[model samples]
Target: MDLRTANMEKNWQLLAGGDRQGLYACFDLFYDDLFRLGVSLYRDVDLVQDAINELFLELWKIRERLGEVRNIQQYVITIYKRVLYKSRHVRQEFASLDECIEMPQSSYEEALIAIQTDERRKALLQQALQQLSERQRQMVQMRYYEGRGFREIAETTGLTERTVYNTLHNALQALRKGMERVE
Candidate 1:
């Protein structure tokens, strides 16, 4: 077998054997591919990484099922697609909710209550985040989560500084509106 195939098989076997190191190694090897797949669909590198990280965590939760995976890379890609699918789906679902769910308050108090650390809470946050557009989500992550400066984000993303600031501003505005509605 070619070296790549051999390595894949070996890692598969190790993962099937419940080797933590092997699973981590596999994650490292496939991270770029999975991230790229996420970016291709979502057009936001940061969200891609977040989605991949979430997927990897979910994979470990089902590690015993690894042996059934005939193609590890394909499995990972499928998971990434599912994440993207959910993001898009959630956004669509919320699009129709304005007339159904009561609109959130114009202020932030009730929205802050929506965030909690329980599984259900995290799931709620994930669901809300999924409703965001790709660029909006990325801007939120860079500005609030990563604490990145607008100029740095602009340089990294090839956007003008003004554009970065505007994106971040717009994203937060959208998020606030969404959160108020969903909250």
Candidate 2:
């Protein structure tokens, strides 16, 4: 009837007919809406993207059986919501150590382990920071330890904002590799 509705029906038919291009077209058309809905429901970008990916994968798997529907958009959204609901329901909440009565000793042990782990992580991070070049290290310290913004760091160091960003990016990559080696 209408252009949007007509397009949806055509795409749905193509999908039902096992046309991969149609599936891609449908993804292109609905991806933004699905992303928005998933984010609103789940509040995690990675989770939302994963859900969308899984949803599309499942749709492709069942494309042949996917019969005609009055509203393709609504149909896809319903599936997305169902997938999210099942994922959300499957999670088991763990009580904090403070909330558990029987594990006080275990809690203390866990706390000690956590503190040691944090110290080791800090030491590794410091080592990684030291591996950075002088200019890169200065940029990182100004941005992170000094709590200065990129613009402020650039102003103080007499570098452009883009240069400051590039320096930080390279520094972070090096730190990541160094930390991985430490791990």
Residue by residue across 86-156, what tens digits does model 1's lDDT show? 76676557777556565433223222233222455566567777877897788778888999988888888
Where does the lowest 10-residue lDDT sum fall in candidate 1? 106-115
TM-score against native, each model: 0.47, 0.49
Superposed by TM-score, candidate 2 places the C-alpha of residue 165 at a distance from the truth, in angstroms, of 25
Per-residue lDDT tens digits of candidate 2, residues 1-183? 888778877887898899998888888878878877876666655556777888888889998787756668788999999877766555313545567465223333454466579899999999998899999999888988999999999899999999999999999999999999989
Q: Global lDDT of each model?
A: 0.71, 0.81
lDDT, candidate 1, at 51? 76
